[model samples]
Structures are given as C-alpha cells and as structure tokens.
Target: MNMDLTHVLDVAQLTDVGKKRDHNEDSVASDVSSGLLVLADGMGGYQAGEVASKMAVLTIMAEMKERLAGSSSGKIDVASGMQMESTLLRDAVAKANAGIYHASRTQPQCAGMGTTLVVALFTNDRVLVGHVGDSRMYRLRGDAFCQITLDHSLLQEQIRAGLITPEQARFSNHRNLVTRALGVDSVVELELHEHDVEAGDIYLMCSDGLSDLVEDDDIYLALRTLNANLTFAARHLVEMANDNGGYDNISVILARPRQPYSAGRHWRHRILGWLK
Candidate 1:
C-alpha cells in the first residue's frame, strides 16, 4: 500500500546570505506532497557556486518527481533488494551529479565548481536519506538529538582514524575541506541510509554554515523548545548560526511528522475488499 505524506508531514525551510558572504551559494527545496527535502551548499568561484547548488537541487527534485509519478514507493527492486524510494533517490543524485559535472567541464566560468548535497524522502513511515560532502541531516526524537548523516570531509576521516578527537576536530582549520562533493569528479558516490520515523520526530537538514557555527547542545535545546512551531525552530537555527559569525551561506530544512503515516491496507484486507 502507498502512503500519502502531504498532510502527515509539516515542513519549513530558510536560507540566508549570511554575515560575511556577498551572495548566498546555498539552495534548498521541499515538496510536502511528495515528502521530499533537499539542501546543497556550493563551493566555487563567483556565481558558479550558486549555479551548481541550484542545478543539483532542481535536477534531483525533478528526476524524483517524474519517476515517482508512475511507481509505488513500497515496491522492492529485484537487483538491489532495496525499496523503490531508496533506489529512486540514489539514481536521482547520480543524474544530478552527471549534469553538474558536465557543466563544470564544458563551461569555463563553472570550472572546478561543486556542491555538497543532502536529500530526504519520507515514505512508508520511514525516511531514506542520501548525502555527499559535509552537508548533513540530524534527527530529534523524544529527548535525544543526534546526527543522522556522516560527513564526507577531512575532519570526519581524521576522527575515524583516531588522528584527532571529535572535540579537537571541531576547532581544526580543515573543517571546510570536504573529501567528496558532487561536480568535483565525473562520478560521485552518494551514501544512502534509512531510518524509522516516529510521530513528533523533528529532522533537520542543513549546510555547514549552521553546523560549523552552532554547537550541538544549543541546536537540541532550540528544537526541543520550539518543535511545536517548525517555522520558528528553523528561523532560530539560522539566527543562531548568524549570531556565531555566519562565515558561510546558511540553509536549513526542518520536517516533522505530526502523526503516524502507516502504509494503507494490509494484503489480506485488500484481498477481502476486492472480493466484496
């Protein structure tokens, strides 16, 4: 059975140029009807970063929407054994990477341009998240707040190797150095994972602009205090980043499922209805 999340999910998003940057290079998009949310943080010269980020967000969203129109999210793929929604998101990210990589090679101004991408698709009472680079997704359930996506950055690699403590890595000069990003190469690998969603769970997708400046504890408090109002929670997060010297473009997407979105109808029930 397919579930419609249009009314089940509450979503809010915001982006800012930030205190230091002359122009914003981050892009964000959300479709409540499709239960899709995407965020990209661009890195490049002049307006090239902005172009790359916008291209990624638009391309991914368009690809997913077109494919989803004809298929059920709960269907399983024979080859990968993953659900249709997960495969769709993976393919969409690949398409977006190809488009951006092609443009970077063909356009002189866009040379060396790339963007970090994070996307979430909510279906069957679960969220399938795909990401590249340092852009991230976080989840807040009950009193626990934790990061959902692991960054593809130098700092993260160091932490994994035990070269630096997570606390020390936070103060490292190489925090902005991402080891992997879309458009930087001909092919980019997207890390995808699935998480169960519960009612009252708040998911945050944001650029490093917010994560780099605000501490995790502060973010948790803000979300816990303002979960009732997602709009205010999103705004407060961006404001906190700016207050801490927003050195980069800031973007955020906050989504909450107000109630359980169980997949409609069991197989036996459907069979009975057909007989009736």
Candidate 2:
C-alpha cells in the first residue's frame, strides 16, 4: 500500500552559507508525500561543490520516488534479504554517485567534486537511513538524544582506533577530512540502516557545519525545548552554528513522526469507513 506522509510526519528543512563561506556548498530536498528527505555537503573547486551537492540531492530524490512508485516496499531482496525500501535507497545513492563521478571526470570545471550525503525514507512505521562521508543523522526520543549515523571521517576513525578521545577529536584539525564521499571514487558504499519509528520521535539530518560548531548538549537542548516547533528549531540550530563562528555551510532537515504509519492502515481505515 502507498501511504501519504503529509499528515503522518511533520518535517522542516533549512540551509545557510554560514559566516566563513562565500558560497553555500550544501543542498537539501524532501517530498513529504513520499516521506523522502535528503541533505548533501559538497567539496571541490569554485562552484563545483554546489553543483555536486545539488546533483546528489536531485538524483537520489528523483530516482527513489520513481522506483518506489513502481515497486512494493515489503518485497524482500533475494540477494541481500533486505526490504525493498532498503534496496531502493541503496541503489538510488549508487546511481547518484555514478552520475556525480562521471560528471566530475568528463567536466573539467567539476573535476574533483564530491559530496557527503544523508538520506531518510520513512514508510511502514520505520525509517530507512543511508549515508556516505561525514554528513550525519541524529534522533531525539524523550530526554535522550544521540547521533544515529557515524561520520566516515579521519577524526571518527581516530576515535574508533583509540588514538584520540571524542573530546580531543572535536578539537582536531582533521575534522573536515572525510575518508569517503560520493563522486570522489567510481564506486561509493552507502551505509544503510532501518529503525523503528515512534510517535513524537524527531530526527535531524545535517551537514558538518552544524555538528562541528554546535555542541551535542546544546543541540539536544534546542531540539527538546523546541520540539513542538520544528521550523523554529531548525532555524535556531542553523543560527547556533553561525553564532559559534559558522566555519562551513550549514544545512538541516528536521522530521518528526506525528503518528505511527503503516501501509496496511490505509486499507483498514477505508474498510471500516465503508462499513460504518
């Protein structure tokens, strides 16, 4: 069954060039009806970063929307044993990567362009999240707020290897050095995961600009304090990042599940209405 997320989820997104950057290299796209949201942070020469990011967001959004419209979400992939939604999201990212990489190689001005991506597809009472590079996704449930996606960056690897603590990594000069990114290579792996959705759960997808400058504690406070107003919360987050020096382009997508959404619910509601 196809479910419309317009009423099921409350979503808002915002992007800023920040104080240090003359041009914004970040991009965001969403289809509330389709429950798809994507954010990208690009890196390269001149305006190539902006181009790469826009390409990534557009490609993934278009590809996923078309594929999902023709396919069944519950169908399981024989090779991966994952749901169709998961497979579709992965393939969509791969297609975006290929398109970006080809453009970077064929177009001189776009040479060396690459982008970090984070995407979320909400359906059947769950959210399928996929990402590459250092862009991230965070979830806030109750008083607990945490990062859902791990950054594929040098600092993250250092912290994982015990070479540096989380606190030290925060101050490390290698924070912007991502180990993986789309368009950087011919083939990029998209990390995918599925999470059960709960009412009142808020998910934040953002570029490093916000995460790097805004402390996690501060983010938690902002999100919790303004959970009732996503638009304000989103703008406030961007403002906080800029207030902290805004060293990079900041982008954020805030999504809150207003109610449990299941494909079967549509049919059930129709049947009950007809009987009544």
Candidate 3:
C-alpha cells in the first residue's frame, strides 16, 4: 500500500447532492498517496445520514493511512485467508463500522443511523475491493464493463433465487433496500474481491444513486467516450444521474492503473496470476 505515487494511477472523483435531496449524504475520498479510495452512501433522517457518511469516510481514510503506514504491507487474515492488502482493507472497514456504531449508540441524533460502504486499495499489481450494502465497484477492461462487487440487498437476493429477473429488479421499488449496512448492528459482514491490475484498467466505485438511475450501458459510454478526461468522466456521470431524476445523493470515484516502469513488473504480475 506504500507505493510511490509517481504516475502510478490516474484518479478522479465527484459527488453531488442531487435535485431531490436537500443535502448530500454521500461521501468519497481518493488518496493516491496512500493508494486508498472510498465511497459511502448514508440513510437516515434528521441529517444523521450526512453525519454517518462523513464519519465513515474520514474514519476509514485515517485508519487505512495508519495501517498502511510503514512497510507492514499486510498479513493474512486468518478468518478469511486473504492477502495483506485485502486484510488491511477489511480491517479498515471494520474499524469504521466500530466508530460509526459507537456514535449511533451514544448520540441521540445518530440513533438508528447507518451507511453503505465501498472501499478499494491498490498495491503493486493488484486491487482489493471491500464493500457492504449496495454501494458497488465496477471494472471496465477494454470494451467490457461489468460489476465486480455483488450487492447485499434484498432485491439481489430475490434475483439470485429466481424470484425476479434483473430487468424486474431494476424497476422494482426496492432499489434502496439494502440488506446489510455499517453501524446498523454491532458487527457487519463485508464482501471482499481481488483482481489483478492491468494497464489501462478502469475501476469505478459509486453509490446507488447513480446505479439506480443511470443504465450500465450509459455509464460505459461515458467512460469510453471520456476515458482520457477522467475529470469530465466523473462530472458527466453525476450529470447523467441528475438528468435521470437524481432521486438520491450521487457520488463516484474513478481510477485507472498505469504501466509500471520496470519490465520486471510484468513478470511479477504474471507470477501473481499463475499463483492465482
């Protein structure tokens, strides 16, 4: 996690309050210095959602920076058997959950508050993604764009059980009905995924606001058209979501991996792929 940020990855981020919401309840952060990225979508009344989302983002960023500091890299988490980067990302999210949960329990305004989280960490040649609730991560490789993180939502479950189809679920009223969320309970289970990084790979982490309103094809189109201008890509995504009703807070973080300087880096990735 402590790699030099010298032309390693291209990163851009954007967030919007949306037309329907009076205040933005989503938070996003990208720290190329620490090779960390995060996004959170919050739900609650009395502005607790905003508080929860901000708290989640700040806590996770701080924890990740601290944990990835020095040369620890990371160690295998016994329960999950994941590599160091994965374990560290898991621990960072867990730490954020603890902080948010503690505040919700003690603060009257924060009672029953929670947020959905999606975090990604970049290492030398891999990406570790961890998420809770419906916040998602998608990877666009060449002409292919597909979601990488499975959602923990009732709608997703119904689709998996064949009770509903993807098209049906899309228009279903359960778009915001997440089955799992941070700070909702004392403990939460996170979904973790890993992928080998390749040059020109584009990763998108976003809240449900964009996914619920904008079609996947549209997202792909924006990224494909504005791939070179990440700033425009991020803005266009939020703009597209708003045009489609923008029923909730919108947030996005885009990252593209860069080629390594040393030829040995390619060999290293090949070795990692072989191990996988």
Looking at candidate 2, the ten consecutive residues that score lowest on lDDT are 1-10
| Prediction 2 global C-alpha lDDT | 0.93
Query: Each prediction's TM-score against the native?
Result: 0.95, 0.98, 0.91
Per-candidate Cα lDDT values, in order, are: 0.91, 0.93, 0.86
lDDT of 3: 0.86
Q: Alpha carbon lDDT of residue 213, candidate 1? A: 97
The better candidate by lDDT, 1 or 2, is 2
Best by TM-score: 2
| Candidate 2: stretches off by over 4 Å | none
Which regions of candidate 1 are displaced past 4 Å? Answer: 265-276
Please identify which of the two predictions, 1 or 2, would achieve the higher TM-score against the true structure. 2
User: How would the candidate models be sorted by TM-score, starting from the highest?
Assistant: 2, 1, 3
Tell how far residue 57 is off in model 1, in angstroms: 0.3
Give lDDT tens digits, candidate 1, residues 1-276: 245578789999999999999999999999888888999999898899999999999999999888888887689999999998888888888898999999999999999899999999888778989999999999999999999999999999999999999999889999999999999988899999999999899999999999999999999999999999999999999999999998988999999998777565334555899999
